[model samples]
Target: MAQQLILVTGAARCGKSEWAESLAIASDRAVTYIATATVDPADPEWQARIDRHQQRRPATWQTMATVEDLAQQIEGAEPTQCLLIDSLGTWVANLLDRSDVEWEKIAQALLAVLPTSRGTIIMVAEETGWGVVPAYPSGRLFRDRLGMLTRQIGSISSTVYLVTGGHVLNLSQLGQKLDR
Candidate 1:
């Protein structure tokens, strides 16, 4: 089968990660779990959350911690390895932190990464635009930019999934039933 890009999106605390993990495990190709989450030493809650995620993933899965240059990492991936990008929301947050970055630039970077990927790629991202607007301009900007990014990614993805309340619903016609 040709390389496929699947975009999985959902609200925070939803089972996006679990679903993505399931997809990766089911695929016969070698799996590469690209984690974008950086450890925050001062935040115990975040650290705990990361630990919980680590406990859930299989030990056999190769993990790569790529905080920056996500596009570079994705672009450099071997054609034989299936890649799981757990959460684009964190990547967007990191991009927002840089004053020189632009939304279109980020979107283009992501688009460039997917076409060259040889194996299946499943991306997980938070669905944050459905909720109340944030008071801060930057927060709102992030939400808006994320919405745009998701739409763009979904356009190129062969399959798109939206998880809510632990239920995963396929949004694309090429969808195969996912065993949750």
Candidate 2:
């Protein structure tokens, strides 16, 4: 089977994570859920959300949680295992302290490594641009940075899905259909 880089993007709470999980489950290879979310024991709501995500995943699937070394983790995985990265937004959020240049460097590294990655890769990202503009500068910065990262990843991805209100749009096909 052909390996694919699939990008699933949508607004918050639009079932993007569930969709990515479904795709990973459908893959023939072993699925490794590369979790980027940081758990805070002090926050009950955050803990509950994390618990919900954990419950949705299959028991057999391996999970690695790390904000950094994403590339290294992906590269070290077995060639036969599919890697499902749940949310790029969180990963980017974790690195907010880095300068734009530093963030860009990381993104560039990811873009370079992903094309050569062994197994089918699925990534989830939030489409935050559709909402109202952020009131604060940092929020705007995060939104803009995530947007740029999404475009870069989507451009390299074999297929891109835009999920909204329980619907999914095949962006690659849509682009072609519209061009014609």
Best by lDDT: 2
- Model 1 alpha-carbon miss at residue 85, Å: 0.5
Pick out the ten consecutive residues of candidate 1 with the lowest summed lDDT: 171-180
Query: Candidate 2, which segments miss by more than 4 Å at Cα?
Result: 176-180
Tens digit of per-residue lDDT, candidate 2, span 1-180: 368899999999999999999888888789999999999989999999999999999999999897967777777656788899988999989988899898888878888888888888999999887788999988998999899888888888898999999998889888742221
- In order, the Cα lDDT scores of the candidates are 0.83, 0.87
Which residue segments of model 1 deviate by more than 4 Å? Answer: 100-103, 174-180
User: Could you tell me the C-alpha RMSD of candidate 1 in Å?
Assistant: 4.4
Model 2, backbone clash pairs (residues 3+ apart or across chains), number: 0
TM-score (all chains, Cα) for each model: 0.90, 0.94
